[model samples]
Target: MEGRLVLALILGVCTAIPCHAYYSPSKPYVPPTEKVTQLHFFLHDTVSGKDPTAVLVARPNFTTAFNNTPIPFGSVFATDDPLTVGPNLTSGVIGNAQGLWASTGQDVLNLVVYWDFGFTQGKFNGSSFSMFSRNTITQTEREAAVVGGRGEFRMAKGFAKLKTYFADFSTADAIMECNVTLIHY
Candidate 1:
């Protein structure tokens, strides 16, 4: 009888003890904050002439190309617009855009755009944000792209939608609208 009792007590104690050495209390789930930013600007065809690779600019001033400097000028991106210019961007620009041709058959343009919010006037004054766009320029509208942010947008994940305002095939000039939605802590 005593042996059986002892075994029962040991079993009870063992079960009472936690299986894991470290026990973390359950935390209440907290959702991340959602942020959305919309930018409407002209994507100027800054290339001098017709070429396969084109460097496009979007800034308050038409002269400034995309650069790393924190300024209010604009962002620069490259695309295969059939219009060409120098591969390098002009000095003293704010943001950059890089485009990689995915496939010749599909004519897919993979765009990675970096926008510097450091020199802005209000709300987003010192943030570095980047977005990836798989744009099939042949199509009028493209799917929402993924965006990962830095600086003030730490731990941010989002979707970005682009709408073409205008596309001039001859001059390779275009205007675009971007709407972005992000969820971050």
Candidate 2:
């Protein structure tokens, strides 16, 4: 009778401990590994005149930046007014962006970037990736934004480090180079 009681007590303690879940008897546990990718691209920004037809009077407004076309106030898409609306923009060819006025109490420029990597070769041949980032850009280098991408970059998250290549203030045009690194499953 004493041996039976002892055996029952031992079994109860073992079940309560959950030792097998932590240290499996069959195979050793291994930590998860992360896969990462890095890329570099150039962003050319051109600030055009405000849209006169736009109904909103907000301090910050939306604008478009064309890929490989660095003209100020010009877009890749067709539009009636090039001076105010720039050009009409298409998917994978434009960055529908907005910049808040410094007087509006925001230090950085909010940008929604749609990068067209379609012309390139290799793994990302025809994928269009987008990122929403804040730019506190200066004359020197800085980490301007945290970027999460779509399409080929699905489920991938990363940061963007950028430095100004050149800036032409008179024309409201600038060239910035960005290095992006992402980690995913």
Candidate 3:
């Protein structure tokens, strides 16, 4: 009985001994940086010459400093008009455009441009614009003149042009202050 009791005590002590396993906390992951080469804005008229006519009340607004520089993440660009019924009779045209340029960081970049037209009381009638890649712009220089000439119809025939190049993003501001000449011919 004495020997059995001693063996049981030894077994209990062995079982009570603690053993530890290895573990490690995870490290946060981060992405690399990219560079932007160029950004350009182009305006165009969608309606044909037979539609309503329009005139330009303001010239094109632009930023040339970053024209040939590298744009980092979180970069932004914005434009607005505070005139009342500048072109459309019922409401005014207000717009804001923003962009970011990156290289290897991420293959895709998000670009948003918004326009509101309706009444001063927060009512929106209608508006139009577009979003696209920069590399797809074939005729960069002629895009402005082509769109400017088409602006003859005011909002009735106005359109926004956007094109994203390799690592650059661009947007044209909303064209305002133009007479919509009705065609009866």
Candidate 4:
């Protein structure tokens, strides 16, 4: 009977021991506040002029290009078009939209694009932001996602709304106005 009581007491004492050395609670982490910036500009793309800003870089098979549809599928073009302050080319030059765009639609007019806006003469000079999007050219308005950026727009995430300011089907020249809103440091 005495041995049983001693064993019970020993067990009870062992169970009451503290375990701070093996486990410690952690504090919650908080992220820093971010700021937002809005930018407006225009992009001029010329594919038929002597000094065309956009050039045909790739195309699909010959049979595919001459398909029943008027629109060519899998046609890729590289562009280093100018970004201006206004819809007109004579407006202030701010940046260049350097990237590639591809016609992905087989029936209608749809283009998948990736562009980098490299600023030159502005408050965000030397800074650059990137965007990737699928634009339905038949529509009046188009939107693209601003994936990333560098310099003043570091870690930028946002969207850009583009409207066709001018277009010449005969010459394959277009001017688009872009309104961009983004969040950054």
Query: What are the runs in model 2 whose C-alpha is more than 4 Å off?
Result: 1-33, 48-122
Q: lDDT tens string, model 2, 1-185?
A: 99999999999988796645765456766745666878665554555456421122222224343222222121222112111111222213323223221211122332323332222344664443444544444345766443444556655666767777766655445556667677754
The CA lDDT of each predicted structure is 0.46, 0.44, 0.29, 0.85
Give the clashing residue pairs of candidate 1, or none: 51-82, 51-83, 51-84
Q: Give per-residue CA lDDT, model 3, range 94-162, as digits (tens).
A: 432222212212223332322222222222223212222232122331121111111222223233333
For model 4, what is the alpha-carbon lDDT of residue 95? 87
Model 1, 64: alpha-carbon shift in Å? Answer: 32
Q: Could you tell me every candidate's TM-score relative to the true structure? A: 0.46, 0.45, 0.19, 0.78
Off by over 4 Å in 3: 1-93, 98-124, 135-185
CA-RMSD of model 2: 11.0
Q: How much is 37 displaced in model 2, in angstroms?
A: 0.9
Candidate 1 lDDT score relative to the true structure:
0.46
Instruction: Evaluate candidate 1 by giving its C-alpha RMSD to the native, one decimal.
Output: 12.3
- Residue by residue across 1-185, what tens digits does model 4's lDDT show? 99999999999988986855686767786765787999989999988858999998887775364254333688889999999998888988898999999888866768898999999996899999999989777777988899999988888999999898887756658888899998876
lDDT of 1 at 3: 100
